[model samples]
Target chain A: MEKIKVKNVFKIFGPNPQKIIPLIEKGKSKEEILKETGHGVGVNNANFAVEQGEIFVVMGLSGSGKSTLIRCLNRLIEPTAGEILIDGENIVGCDKDTLLQIRRKKMAMVFQNFALFPHYTVGENVAYGLEVQGEDLETRHKKAYEALELVGLKGYEESYPDQLSGGMQQRVGLARALATDPDILLMDEAFSALDPLIRKEMQDELLVLQARMQKTIIFITHDLDEALKLGDRIAIMKDGVIVQIGTPEEILTHPADDYVRDFVQDVNRVKVLTASAIMKKPDAVVSRKDGNKVAIRKMQEAGISSIFVTDKERHIRGIITIDDAMALLKKGEHSFESIINTEVPTTSPDTSIVDLLPIAVDTKYPIVVVDDDKKMLGIIVRVSVLSGILGEEE
Target chain B: MDKLQIGIYFEALIEWLTNNLEPVFEGLRTGILALIEGFEAFLLFIPSYVLIAILVVLAWKIAGKSIAIFTAVGLLLIDLMWLWPQTMQTLSLVLTSTVIALLMGIPLGIWMSQHDVVDNVTRPILDFMQTMPAFVYLIPAVIFFDLGEVPGAVATVIFAMPPVVRLTNLGIRQVPEDVIEAARSYGATRKQMLIRVQLPLAMSTILAGVNQTIMLALSMVVISAMIGAGGLGEEVLRGVTQMEIGKGFEGGIAVVILAMVLDRITQSLGNTGKTK
Candidate 1:
């Protein structure tokens, strides 16, 4: 299900915005429109849908209307024209009460600057959404604590915002947004104000939380690396219009325009490209119950140095080199278990290629990609990882 | 040619108000008098010693022990100089006018903060109210309420109300934009935003406004006394009229003592509000 759909939304900031919106749709440049009508174009025909559990990123430089576009989704900045459908309900035309209800029940936003109430304690700030919804005190408190714990801020509940560091305060901001357990989270440069190390930690924390909760999120940022790292699908905006929307790999490999190409040019591909992007299907494999002769034949036929040995469930048991398999066959070994080498390095499919660099450097055999149950999914050799970074096809 | 006649319109407006709103003026005069009389009676009913002790304790609790000691000595000096009754009268007048000012000013200020048009319209009116001599309003006050503490309080309220209204509007408007947006994003109703986010965050600034209102009200005491209001101002007026230097010094000292004590306490209150 689509959690949010923003269709051809226009946000013109000036008197008689409705009249100026037609100029925007007629392909007038922002400067031209401003010159003609004195209207500032906030978002020019923004259109996108956020699928359930997807993290959709809107990336743009300042004044590109990224923030304005995100604000329009929750009707914080009302669109001059067009529809914003959240779960199929167009909120652009919602009445004040209905808008409030939807904002309280369906969406929560985190700001670039942690917009914590200075007078409020951490717990009170976190519980604010619930309090505004008129939930009873006990439930608000309980949920507040749960949210704080989720964001790794359990005992700092009674502390004022000023007493905490900027990073800790941002955690409180995140907790406040999550306290209501709203289905969609709107993060407008939520980590842009934090220092780099803290911002990285927060990004990892959000990813961990997303894995568990699967909440639909619309994250806005100007940093290409952040967008590539965090976005399931990224929308690059320029001059109040979305220029391109694609997955991180697709964006890196095939930029939509000169601006997008320039944006991706300096990005660290090893950090952005995951192991799955470069990993190939294993050429040969041997079941653990297979005799040495079977393992040797599979490796020779596939022209591989060794064969990965797996159980009936495809759980990687070990690997057997062709030389070892031949020696075992001469000894008349019924099983290849004695020749199996268990020390080959393994990585998850989602691990960034940069993180796998050292492991790849140390291992002679192709690195195995495994799921949580240790089932072998694919293999990544050095050349594939190198070619992934070089943007070369193999 | 003929002289410009702006004063004629003013006179007509005042005449119309007097004639048509007689009952309203009477009700206001009665209400103000009753409040001042009640406060004065309460202050006098407490044994002088008990009142001093309570004030000392309140100063200590709100400001600090040093301020409490200074307050005790100041009040004792006023009593020793036989100015206790007059001081109590001044205190009562100041308190009544301030309460009235707050009652009228805060809501107006909040309304102004929400509506730019109202703020713009009243901004010059506030300037006129502030820059006009305190004695000028006494003419209308006396005409409406007839030369007594009520008229005195009316003049004081008009003189002191501007700062509170202006500051309250400023405080509410100065609440960080992001904070208000955060509240709005959380679905806070307008009333909820005002009470929970705007007002609480503006509290320190508003309390500073209150302090300014009280100080301005105190400054009006001598002017109000020209309309036959009794207080240290009457003593100062008599000292000036009769050319008695001792009496003038006593009244001047008493006024200073009261102003300092009130200023310290209210400033402390504003500071504490910010920390909370």
Candidate 2:
């Protein structure tokens, strides 16, 4: 189930995006609209939905409206034109009271810099969101301590923000956000301020937290690797619009446009794609049925290209010599898990034909395609991966 | 104590000794008297009382060149007025009160910070202490200690202690949250944190409070002298009573000089923490 949805989010940073809407509709450039009206667009027609208990990342360079988009989801910053649907209800016109209720109870945000109040102890900072929402001292303390315990800061309850290191302070920030037990976690580059080592640790900690808590998270970042490592589905954004929204594997192997392709070009799809694409057919079709050379000749001759251990018959079985399969076995195994060693060559159906061709060209194996049931559907030759790159659709 | 000025309090200790308590009280009494006598000796040891420039230069070095020049000119004018000796008496009394105020104020401030009860209980008292008229303190000092440098100095100390206490407390409290948390995470106890992190960070503000205390003490010269303080205050008193215009002018000028010099020196000391 989708937990939250952002539809046609346009947060313009001036008097009116309404006036500019007609120009945009007419396919006029943003430069032309701004030249006429003198207003800038922050986020332009962004649309995406996040599933419950998923880490849906929004990635862009700074000023690409990634932060603004995330902020709009929680209404921390208002969107000029959008409908935010949390659990299938529109929150576009939510009143102050309703917005406060949603913010306090459903979502909590963690900032880039650890926004722990300087005067507060770690425990107090963690408990503050609860306190702001009107929880009493004992209840809030218990909840805050529980959240701290979850983050492995159990004994640090009495320590002030200054007493902690940058990492520890961010942990307090995370714990504070968690204390409210919000249904959605909106983290705005929360660990970017930390050193590289600390950022890695916090990232891993967030993964573990997500695994345990299973809350819907909208993680925003400029780091592509962080997005890949954390996001269940990434929405790669550029110039305020989403270029694509897909799983990390999908983004890497099947990018939607030149922008997304360039963005994921550095990714190693050989490692990311599974083993269903490069497998051979299970029912080997032998052309000649008698002599030893005839069997090898038949295996070579058949365009179905089967090294058959069996036949298409009622419990039909055939004998296989070691030499008959050895030449073909060196090519690759076509399996779903890709749990085999890197020494093996295999590809998944999800692997882009363009990305899979080089390995195929070297090894001379068929590009295997499998169904959801792990049944081998067919095999694509090395030329198909190359052909797809050339815009020849089959 | 060296017993150079240890009075009968030292001798009668053994006679009244019911326990170790007698010696403790006697020891404290002797220590205090020794400090006073040491100060007295210090004031008199100067040859020609020409150490004033050292203070003047120090004030400039610490506070700035302006304070230094002001101090030098003020002292020169007082000497020209022929009130140098009387100025020394007034300086001694003001210094005595300031030392006592610091000795008492800082610990009370620290104590107040440590205990919520003490801070809450004493807040109103300190408010009253600061807001009340200066003469209200003098009446009690005169009634209990008799009119002299002792009562006058004691009264000045009481009158000036509140600001030192308040500033010290505020400064320590205002030390950044991160600094305190850093200390705590390092396993610093409450006392250790207070002494190490809080006190050092709060030093500038505390010194500012001390500077204010010193200035307040200096301003009390005529007030203290009116209650029998033996310094430039007495010179001014003489000027007023005898209707001697020459004496009054000399006394008033001497006072302005003393105030400027002390103000500059303490202010310099307070500001030294800044450039560093």
Candidate 3:
């Protein structure tokens, strides 16, 4: 279901932003306006919906209205026209009271410059929204404390924004957003101001949070790689319009147009892929004279549903039956390759987790990893793929 | 090379604007006529001078006890030199001018910031205003408003306005673009952004402009006396022309006193805007 929906929003700049955009939208350019009175468009026609619990990234260059688009969602720069529904309630022309209520309870934004009020301590900056929401000092302070801990900035509560490095300041900004326990987090190029190393570190931290808190986020960025890395689904914007929106894989695998394709052309798809690829067919059966105890232990170590046999030189021979291990006795000069079964099971290393599961499930043994070449890399199971995607053991 | 040209003011300037400059001197002939014609030129002087004292207190609050003491000593010197009442009248004239200049200049600056058209149009006017010299400058104020505290203030505003406008506009514009975008995203209403983000961030630069504006206004106090404006400027005028060395010294000292007091207060304010 949609969590935040924006419909036909328009923004224009003039004495009456509300009144002027339509006049301009009706084919009146800024040059024409300057020729007439003055002022021009800040944002034009826009519309989108963000899914609940999904990380939606909006990527754009400077002045592409990516920043303006996100701001419109919060009614920060009230749109000249359109409707905004949060949890199915219309907030398009929401009053200050209702708007503050929505901002306090539902939506929060992390800024590019880390926008921590410089005069405030890091802890206080985190607690600002709560304080604004009229939460008691004790409760907000406690909430702020917990938020800091979540962002791994527990001891930095008393520090000022200037005293910390750029990354640390942004961490405080993140902490401030989380302290409100917001349902939707809007990050506007939040890491763009950070140095590259810190940017990556912050990106990792965001992944960790998304893994746990599962807060639906609408992140704005100019960098396509950042969009690819953070977004479950990315919406590309240009000149105040949504150019394309889809899962990163879909966008990469099948770009909607030349614009989208060119945008993602430089991306390294290999780095984004996984293992469980190019598993070779099980080889002809050869007798495994290895004892039952050794065979059982090997099967258990592989953690595969069943164990496979290979030769001393690491060539697959045939698969061993659990019954074969049970019946087996003392070391009989056994090699797994002798027991290898000739099943030509294979998958690519870049296979996505969603597509990897069935191939792995149907396999009789652990899947082997490989590159574009026929060469074998290693193995992968359902669990490994899940862990890689989920980012942790949990 | 620029330093080599020090201790010079009028000769080169006169040479540069020889013919057009001659008509400007003719305005001095009609100075009395200009004085009679210009009425609004003498705006709110007495009360505004009182306001200046209030500002001094405000500055002292921000700047520290030392500044307050300095201000008192400066005013006392103005009093001791027997130019206290004249200083007050001049103070009134300057106060009126600076306030008007800030009012007109600041909103124009803000307008410049909000639109490309306003900026493009106003920029050249601002440039012209900034470049025109004082002796060369006072002629228009004379022609339009005539000689008096009114014309004097008008002149002072012309001389003193650009820095405040330029600085305040620049200061607001200079705020981190991201910070402004953040404020926008946070749903800050236009008024909220102006009051909170723009003004707070630009306060330092704006304060510098204001400080400069006020000092420039005070410096004009003496020049303005040529048009029948009073204050220590008149005393300096009388002291120099009458060739009373003791009178000149005291009047000069009194002018210094007024400048010291106003300068200290404003400088303190500028520093506080940035420092805190």
Candidate 4:
């Protein structure tokens, strides 16, 4: 299901938005539009859809209209013209009361600067949304504590915002947003204000929380690396227009234009290319019940030193070397499980190449890729990992 | 354009207001007189020693032990100079005018902060109110309310009201944009935004405005006394008229003591608001 659908939204900031919007539509540049009509285009005909539980990232440099676009989704910044559909309801034309209801019930936003009220205690700040919704104090307090616990701020409820560190204050902001339990999360540069180390920690925390919560998140960022790391799909914006949108791998492998290509050229692909992207289908896979002769013959035919052994259900049993398989055949072993080496290094499909570097370097055989259930997926050879880090061949 | 003669139009406008708004002026005069007289009577009802003790304790609670001691000595000195009653009267006037200024100014300031049109309209009017000689307001006040403590308070209120309004508007407007956005994004109503975010954040600035209003009111005391608003200002006026240096010194010292006490108390209040 599409949780959010933004269609042809335009936000022009000036005295006469309607008059200036035609200029925007006529392929006028932002500077030209401003010069001609004394109006600034905030978001020019932006259109996108966020699938349920997906992290859709909008990334651009400052004044690229990324922030304005996110704000428009929730109508925090009113759009000059467009339709924003949440659950098939057009919020663009929603009345003020209905918009307030949507903000309270459907969406919550996290800000970059940790906009926790300075005078409010952490608990009160967390409870603010519920308070505005007219919830009972006791219920809101309990929910606030649970939200705080989710953000790893368990007992700092009584403390003022100024008492906490910057990271902790941002945690409070996140907690406040989460306390409402809204289905859609709008995060506008939520971690850009943190120190680098803290920023990484917060990004990881957000990913962890997302895995558990499964909230549809529309994340805004100026950092390309963050978008690649966090986004299921990324939209690249320039001069108030969305230039390109694709998966991180697609964006990295096939940029739409010189602008996007230049953006990806400087990105560190090692951290972004996952094991799944580079991993090749295993050539020879023998069942544990298969005769040892079959394992050796399969390895020989495939020109490989080793063959992975799996059960009937494709659950990884272990790997067997050609020499071991040959020796087992000579010994007339009925089951290859005896000689199977379960000590072979394995990684998940989602593990990045940067994380697999040491494991890949130390392993003689290709690294086995497995799912959470230990089902064999594919194998990662050193050459494939290297090529994945470098871009795809033309 | 040989001297626009704008004052002639102002005079005509005032005349029209006076004629047409006589009932409104009467109602305002009655309310203000009642409040001032009530406050003065309450202060007089308390024994001087008890009142001093209460003030000392209040100062101690609000500021510190040092300010409390300072207040005690200042009040004692005023009493010893035989100006205690006059000092009480001035306190009443200052308190009355300050209360009225705050009541009117804060909401006006908040309204200005909320609307650009109101801010634009009032900004110049505030400038004129601030810079116009304090004596100029006294003439209209006297004409409207007749020469009394009420007229004095009316004049003082006009003089002192500007800072409160200006500072409140500034404070509310200067509240961090991100903070206001946060409030709005959370579905806070306009009232919720004002009470929960804007006012609390702007509190220190508003308190500073209040402090200025009180100080300005105190400065108007001697000037008000010339219009028959009896207090230490009366003694100062008498001394100036009869050339009694000794009497003038006593009244002047009492006024100085009262000003210090009020200024310290209010300034400390602003500091407290800031820290909180």
| Ranked by TM-score, top first | 1, 4, 3, 2
Error of 4 at A376 (Å): 41
> In model 2, which regions exceed 4 Å deviation?
A29-37, A269-394, B1-276
- Please identify model 1 stretches exceeding 4 Å from their true place: A268-394
Worst 10 residues of 1 chain B by lDDT: B133-142
Best by TM-score: 1
Ranking by lDDT: 1, 4, 3, 2
What is the fnat score of candidate 2? Answer: 0.00
Answer with 3 or 4, whichever has the higher TM-score.
Answer: 4
lDDT of 1 by residue, A1-394 (tens): 9889888899999988999876765778999999988999999888888899999999999999999999998888989999999999999988999999999999999999999999899999999999999999999999999999999999999999999999999999999999999999999999999865578679889999999999999999998768988999999999999999999999999999999998887664457677766777788888977777777888889998888988899999888898887887788877777778998799997898778888988889899999899988788888787787775644
Instruction: Kindly indicate the candidate among 1 and 3 with the higher lDDT.
Output: 1
Model 4 lDDT tens row, A1-394: 9999999999999998999877777788999988887899999998899999999999999999999999988888999998999999999888999999999989999999988899899999999999989999999999999999999999999999999999999999999999999999999999999855478679889999999999999999998878988999999999998999999999999999999998998675567667866677788899977888788889989999998988998888888898887888788877787888988889998898888888978988889888899988778887777777675521
Model 3: per-residue Cα lDDT over A259-317, one tens digit each: 88877765543334345322223322223556446666765665433555544544544
Tell me model 3's lDDT, rounded to 2 decimals: 0.72
Query: DockQ of each model against the real complex?
Result: 0.58, 0.02, 0.16, 0.54
Q: By DockQ, rank the candidates, best first.
A: 1, 4, 3, 2
Clashing pairs in 2: A162-B178, A163-B181, A163-B182, A277-A347, A277-A368, A278-A368, B63-B268
Please give the distance, in angstroms, between residue A333's alpha carbon in candidate 2 and its true position after superposition. Answer: 56
lDDT of 4 at A280: 70
Error of 3 at A246 (Å): 4.1
User: Which has the better TM-score: candidate 1, or candidate 2?
Assistant: 1
Candidate 2, residues A1-394: lDDT per residue as tens digits? Answer: 9899888888777687677756665776556666878877677888888889999998888878898888788666688887999999787888766776777778887878776666567887788677666679999889998999998899999887878899988898889889888989888898789855467679889999899999999999998778988999999888777889999889988999998887777555433332332333333433223334444555566634434322233122333433534443554432212221123234445666556767777854454454455334445566656545553433
Worst 10 residues of 2 chain A by lDDT: A333-342
